[model samples]
Target chain A: METMQPALKNGRNVWDSVNMPKEEFEARIERVRTAMAGRGLDLLLVYTTGLTDCGDTAYLTNFVIRLTRGTLVAIPRKGEVVTFFEGSSRGLPSLKQTLTVGDLVAAGDLPKESAAYLKETKVNVGTVGLAGLKRMPFQQYRTLTSALEGCTFKDADDMLADFRICKSVRESDQVRRAARIVGKLTMFLKETTFEGASQRAIEAALYRQARFEGAEDFRMLLAKPGREGCSVGPADYVPMADGEKVIFYLGVEFERYWAEAIRTFTFKAGSFVEETSPGIISGFQQLCAAMKPGVAISAFCKKASAVMAGKGHQALAPFGLGGGIGLGLSEKPLLTEETPGELKEGMTFALRMTAESGDNYAMVGNTVLVGKDGGIILNVEPARPAE
Target chain B: MSDPNLKLEKTLELINKKGLDGLIIYSGGTCSILGPSYLTYFCEARPLGPRNCAVVTKDGRVSLLVEPVWDAPRMAAKAWITDVRGTSRFTDDLLEIVKGYGVNGTMGLVGGREMSEEVYAAISGKVKLEPTDAIVETLAREKSARELEIIYRASRIADLGFEAFVGCARPGMREYDLTAEMEYVMRAEGADDIFILISSGSHNYEMHEPTDRRLKKGDIIIGEITPVCEGQFVQLCRTMTLGEPAPVVYEKYRMLLHAFAESLAQIRPGVEASAMSKAMNQVISDAGYAKYCYPPYMRARGHGFGIGSIAPGGVIDDNTKAAFERLQAVVVHPNQYIPETGYLACGETVLVGINGIQRLAATETKLYVKEV
Candidate 1:
């Protein structure tokens, strides 16, 4: 759940044509243009920071900033799509490697440069749609709003979100690849002797292996559930004591798609054994059985809550039940009690379950595919119930 | 949370001096090695969630509001402030705290660039905002004894990371895999975070995120290895050769060594920060590549680092206004580009002390050539 720590982006970063080709982005832009026409928006300005919120921009243009800066993809009603990022012009050689958009401009200030583009292209008088405007830095937002005097602004976050909720064939493949990389990460953990090793030793080795397996980005949060304090990221690098139960929440983003999974393990003897609870498994399986293409997300959330309650598992408010995953860690059609949306086929969502395991809390979940036939659990075989 | 009282005491003094009702040290969950979290400077708690802020009013009342709710317990243990709460309802809770204090006239805002439209609007409805990044900058311009220790430790981690780069990098290894090995060594050395950029090829343009591009025998692997320890980010820019033998590569890297040394010679407690860059640029210019010293080829010759103030700021080019001050932690690099070698990295972090400059890392800045 602690997914917001700033990423170093120290892993594999590329725009693989085989995985997500330029044709995909071209189709995405065409669809966005059609959507803009429906909404009477002459230009759609998609915005996202370089952090976990870079889905909208990455969805439209395969470009993602490695640094903590702002990026805007301006898709006009027609003409070549332009990408603006907050950086120096020198970054083009590196940025152009991943950016599918043709017209890339590096600016000291994205808002100021975007405003200049708006005037240069005579877009100030046109109705513009802003996606992910709320997430933009206030300084940039202020600059953008103040610079464009005659522009009409409309919120297109939902429109862009609607487009991203359902993954295409290529997008689903990316997620599957991401999930497979996650499998390698967990496999490395099981194979290595990290049970009694220091936390940093295990984390460093695990991350190294994950990158070798082609992880673009990685995040992990270990829950020493019965420990003294929250102990975020194991600051002291405490050695894992024998027979200690811990939940390892790993989110691996391969290419641009994210595949998040939570696994529970108990260190016994000299090896780590899976301790995923039976209740958590049965509860998620029931939800999978209930899922269909047209099922409402609210109903899914309701079922999840009821099913977990029956299994003696409590929904911890801090770590959410789970949400849709694809381009973003959590995208539209999020699983929440009040989320108003319907699940569609090809939409991927990760479901998480938390249950008290004796003296400690254990968690387990997997990336599930909202299939045309039924819900498909993407990865993570449920381990045997702990004695 | 070492010397939290010192920071709080300084902040309170500034509040009194500026006649402000209170001060808010905020973190938008955007922590960079260059510009770290200001909230961490004030309270020593690196915020894991977005919109983590601490309110320090004039009456000595302090409250820490963190998002994600789960991070609150960890923050509580890390922060000296006892009033730490994991915030669920963001804007409402923040406004409530501001309103409850009856001190909503003019509040100093740190980490203001991180604020979003909603947060700025919600806070602006109540108080006037004063850009107060300087408050923390002033507090951090001079390092404490503990800060120097952390800076050195972080620098040592950077050294180890680069050593890993030297050991793990070889022919057929992907760029990402090389970085991962480096990150592993740094993390084992207690680095809380790491930022690494790598470029490998015959003619490298710039260092970006690690890619699947494989390193070849003659590839020049350039890496900007930064390992952050307790938010004290130390960067080491290095250029390595998979196998020796390009005369131009050796010549260009040696020129960079001269530029870096000249830059180091220009550091003092009273000189302009731009002077170091100018001195470095002059050496490059004397080498007959003056045109490449500016943008599109070169970035900041150096930058400052700390959890709080990254003073002497981003680019220490011809226009940087900040001056070199005593005990200021800064990274001096002569990372440059030439048509011959594409680009080469050479630099190390240092402490500008009262006596002279203190090099933090034990690794010497030079071209490290790994025999194939």
Candidate 2:
């Protein structure tokens, strides 16, 4: 329960290596039960609609919906957990393969189905904790409340978020696996960039390599030095010109765990040169050295700011430093001055630092795991310095 | 590039028509190809995380609030809205923006269904919040020239996807491997997003996500190839066989092909959307599968694909009364499950034209056989 089985121990299948074992899920459920008891909640209902919100449900069941649909998980304080899927009955076969939750039901309408389940189980009259309430449709919330009749509902989104924000040994291992994929992909990107290669071809190379390495989900953000900023959508058809500056921020999810990597490069004499400053790289390494358990995340932000400033540089606010990474790509304990939390041992985070020097901007990002000793850089795709 | 200002103009017109102080349209969750993320329709930048909101003031001012903080740059890079800001706290930033527009009058809220209850309460506590999904839908039903261009490009990618699905189908290949190959092809072709579902075996009940199951000779494969380019989506539900040798499969497939052709023929400007379903159902009924024409057999004849503006409105059933308009894009999938051959898929996307439906897919609807 402390550490997860390694994804690639000795030349196992990529799929076999990357997937979470059943013990990991069992340990997670035990953790949730303990947290649920502390909160005096009888049942925890996790509702998720669409792709991004599935983190809450996936934490318990490992069931991620591929399409844009609503899904709910009802975890009782004592017994079996039931999942209400957003699809039809025909999806049961696929659902069974993807999840371990035994009591799976097909619900065309999630709210109505959940209400019926609550009433049937006679738990509708008790105190129920709800996560992902904000993501649910308003009408469904009204329906759920009306059906509960006498039940008192409380926001338990943070309860789940708080539990998931910190990674376990296994979760950290998954992050490492995901980070490894991101590292390899970024390296491929660096090697593939040419004077005339289109962004489409570059992204295609990324997709091919990441998926081959068993990445469940992959997202990319790219920007030219002169562009307004980076976007997480399609790559344009424009071919790269010689000496054009490009910045790439890539993230990948393996076995439902997340990691990220960012690098800024300029296409030079038929190659890519790391368009970054020694100050920024030093600032990043300094920030990593500063990351320790019990250090307030805000304090880390201040330290990052100071590190950059001492190096005659300034990092961007809000998004520059980092945030906790685990089940979700950007989890709580965000590394920002305004955030009110402390970094804990066993938390994995992505430190993305963007600095502006004159008319150019450079960014360096990598996933780091907070250990008892210090921070461990999980996905290390080192940049080749500018010539 | 399409003028992001065109959407700003439309939002202003909507605000004026609804007599609202401002409009708040939001997209929840970054992964939804078809969720209530109408913000993409207005801003052109679909967020990649949970919760992005756009505030359109009646005075020609538009601002976007993006979540996950990292995507802020992406939103600014892609969206036409000049006042895009990134935030870690979604509800607070949303409240701040809504109040900036004088939050005392009726505020039209698009994508209300996807809004969390806490967000709704906070906003409505300040003003009269009204759901503007229908209004956005009405406006989105007619595509702009730029929207059509993106949708058409997405359709061409869908065609390439099917070509991959066909070219890569062979015995001994795992379903997921086939999916990986096809997705690589589409992604290389500039498909920004894709949702592929595959089911193999001659007795395929329905299309599902690819599994570890390996294809064998004589096993038929069904796939729904959906690709999105710049928020515009195009889908094709096609079927292929590892080897040709089934009279009943083709017989059942021909019925679906006939239904598909007749259904597409029913498309024209001003036609009731339900007519497409009825025409499709009639062909299935003539083939003596009327009992199976309803749910569990198939739920939709086709659905409109866009950000959130035009859905098949509802599933294309006999009871639907929504009418088609010019420039609306829809996928006419007549994928059916019958006792004769289990299930078969045949469909293509089309653009509703002034006189007839414009087919986006060049691949004709038929039972494509891969020579083993």
Q: Please give the DockQ score of every candidate, comma-separated.
A: 0.67, 0.28
For candidate 1, what's the RMSD? 2.7
Expressed as tens digits, the lDDT of each residue in B1-372 for candidate 1 is 577787788889988898888888888886776575688778876787878899889878899999877788878988899999888887788878888888857899888888888788887777788888878887876678878788888888888998899998889988888888998899888888889988999988888888888899999989899988777888899999999949989888989999999899888888889999999999999999899998878878899887778878876887787888888888998888888888888998888977568888798788999999
| Isolated chain A TM-score, each model | 0.91, 0.88
Candidate 2 docking class = acceptable
Q: Each candidate: how many clashes?
A: 0, 2
lDDT of 1 by residue, A28-139 (tens): 8998899899999998888888578788888888888877788888888977788888888987877788887658889887899888987797766678888877778788
- TM-score result, candidate 2: 0.86
Error of 1 at B285 (Å): 1.1
Clashing pairs in 2: A134-B116, B304-B312
> What is candidate 2's lDDT per residue for A294-383, written digit by digit as tens?
888888889888887776556543336768787776777777889887878898988877777566678788899998866888996647
The global C-alpha lDDT for each of the candidates, from Candidate 1 onward, is: 0.82, 0.75
RMSD of each: 2.7, 5.3
